[model samples]
Target: MRLFEPNTAALQALKGSNINITLDIRNQDLADLAASQDAVNSWFNTNVEPYLNDINFNFIAVGNEVIPGSLGGYVLPVMNYLQKILDDKNLHGIKVTTVLPGNALQSSYPPSSGAFTSEASSVMSGILSFLSAKGSPLMINVYPYFAYASDPKDVRLDYAQFTAKGAVVRDGSLSYYNLFDAMVDAFFAAMEKAGRGDVGVVVSESGWPSDGNGNFTTPKLAGTYNRNFVKHITSKVGTPKKPGAYIEGYIFAMFNENQKPSGVEQHWGLFYPNKQPVYPVF
Candidate 1:
């Protein structure tokens, strides 16, 4: 499934693809919307209801990586209001959730030691409760690239790219061969510790940048990472921690967004602006 922040042109472009979409609600004051039923209704009517039939909407992400802070406090309330609107409108197929950054967790090393930060604990609890009640998956954006970029001296490039070269991270008896798997398992561990192990996880965003400051952020490596990722998820092998569990994921972007910040931000695209493939993704 592909994810897109709601926009008229993009939605129009996807009219008949029948591809599942995770629509994002961005740039709006979620707190204000949560407090007012009229605002939520109007926003939905303008942004979603009109395209309900033409678009294959599966999830509504309230905000991307906005939690663990003051803005994060609005997540649960906004999700509740949005979910109620969906239920009232009989939109049962579309689940409401928010995307969280990998940094939301205070610690993720060793995978098993995963836990949300103290600042995020209370808010995450409420978010988890809402997700559990609504049967929505907990969305998280995991980027092994950032981890490697932060510590190139210690972090193995091969491990971050899924080519571990026989290297394994021993977290207890479990051995993690790749950073992606370890990162995902860490989130699972955190969720379990948070008392909501049953709630499913969706990798809302994961990808490598083709061009950036780091040496590893090259077109070839990006292609390799994405291609391997597609294979990994499609094989249904799951991660070591959540064996046999189906974890739905979406690649970071469809095109290189030039307006984004200078470094890696503009380079996480699978395609160029002219619609040519960056690499053979399939």
Candidate 2:
């Protein structure tokens, strides 16, 4: 199992490959009081700043799964850490974000009624405020399979998998054939509630698994779900709610790793370990 590490040299190769990578660093101690100023200076100066060329850089993720309901206690401070790094480096163009799990929103179905968990709202309010002021977009990691895998009997396969399902039932309006758009609308609703409706929503992470580890749902379904998702994304047709804005998403992964955690996350890659294509990319 090869570990994924990012450094000055490694970052250059990654950017040269034209891969927009989002680095998750919530586990690191960037926000700690004991964190050295020199260390932070060295990091951005030595590791990040050297390679600011287009296509070589995308975003710097401050936290992962560190929302109020789960690990949010770390969010406020980590967010500050991100801000300081950006300011100290005098950097521009790179986005600083805290990649939040979808649960940060209260209800994410029907493309509306999006709210925060209450526990996360105040902190998220602060977060959205920061993103707005900083001209940075919020990052969200969503996976329909988790909701569907939890209750496959209730969730429709075609809609959840991005296949052409009869339009979904919403507010007495026959709308939404794919969950991607519906899911995005849910986030849009969340921002509206937060008074940040104008803020752009980007899928920090989203993907379907190629295997369910015998959890009842099959890998084939997950793979098909991923392929179709990319289709809708690349088609340039934005979400039903935000037709004016082109929905942007970074597919969960480029390649599968056998050493990755055993669960839905590990299998959420388009390619297998040996560089084999899981399915037709188109």
Candidate 3:
């Protein structure tokens, strides 16, 4: 599971379970954490140190999808500081990274042609270098829904929902049957272009909303995509580019947030705020 912030209540709720967490330090906190080592230490002590023994903290996302923006610079510095804090405490199991949206890439189609935009390249180069050195994976928010939504005329719904019967796109040797793999491979290609092919990728967020977009964001489509996503990850049939590689992923949310910006953003959750599942995910 991925938490946007270190909510003490949510942390307490996850106390004894074996759930691997991808905890995030809100984007707004990046500048503060980057400027002061003391802040980073306090943040860690307050949010992580208390539950170290009970919760399985996997990755600390310093910032979410801040790249190609002003806050981009702070991401790596905060990650470096957080990594040192963990190192000093002899807690090396948790990795430090940042989440990036698909727009980070300039060319994603054809997968082989994937390359980061000039802006993202400048930032990701350093971030990718850090990841390579730390042996940490890059967290990418892969949303095929966006790709399909933007160009539904050309991008088929079956391809995005993982229900396509066969390969829908062929990029040289890579035959992409689903948009998910194509999107992921595009990131891989971009990383390779940045000279860090060794760095792995984790799908930090990916889900179709349960409502708010007519036929595109219906509960049925959302459930189908998620259910197939779980099966695809568990099957270990990695993308065509990296066959058999284990891909760790997480759904966008657990429950609907009415407070979120209206429309599809507020409906990515698998369950309603009332706790009833919008659709059977498992």
- Where does the lowest 10-residue lDDT sum fall in candidate 1? 257-266
Off by over 4 Å in 3: 258-266
Q: Which lDDT tens digits does candidate 2 get at residues 1-282?
A: 111234545565565666666655534544552255465556556556666663445577666666765456656555566568777667665676676777777787666777777887877887888788887777777777776767778877676788765776463352788776777778778878998887776677777776645643456776687778778777877777777576567777778777654654456667778988877665
lDDT of 1 by residue, 137-217 (tens): 998898988899899888888888888777479988788889999999988899899999888888999999887665667
Q: What is the lDDT of residue 144 in candidate 3?
A: 88
Ranking of models by TM-score: 3, 1, 2
Winning candidate number (TM-score): 3
Cα-based lDDT for every prediction? 0.85, 0.67, 0.91
TM-scores for all candidates: the values are: 0.94, 0.84, 0.97
Clashing pairs in 1: none
Q: Lowest summed-lDDT stretch of 10 residues in model 3?
A: 257-266
- By lDDT, is 1 or 2 better? 1
Model 3 global lDDT (CA atoms, 0 to 1) = 0.91
Q: Clash pairs of candidate 3?
A: none
* Local error of candidate 3 at residue 89 (angstroms): 1.3
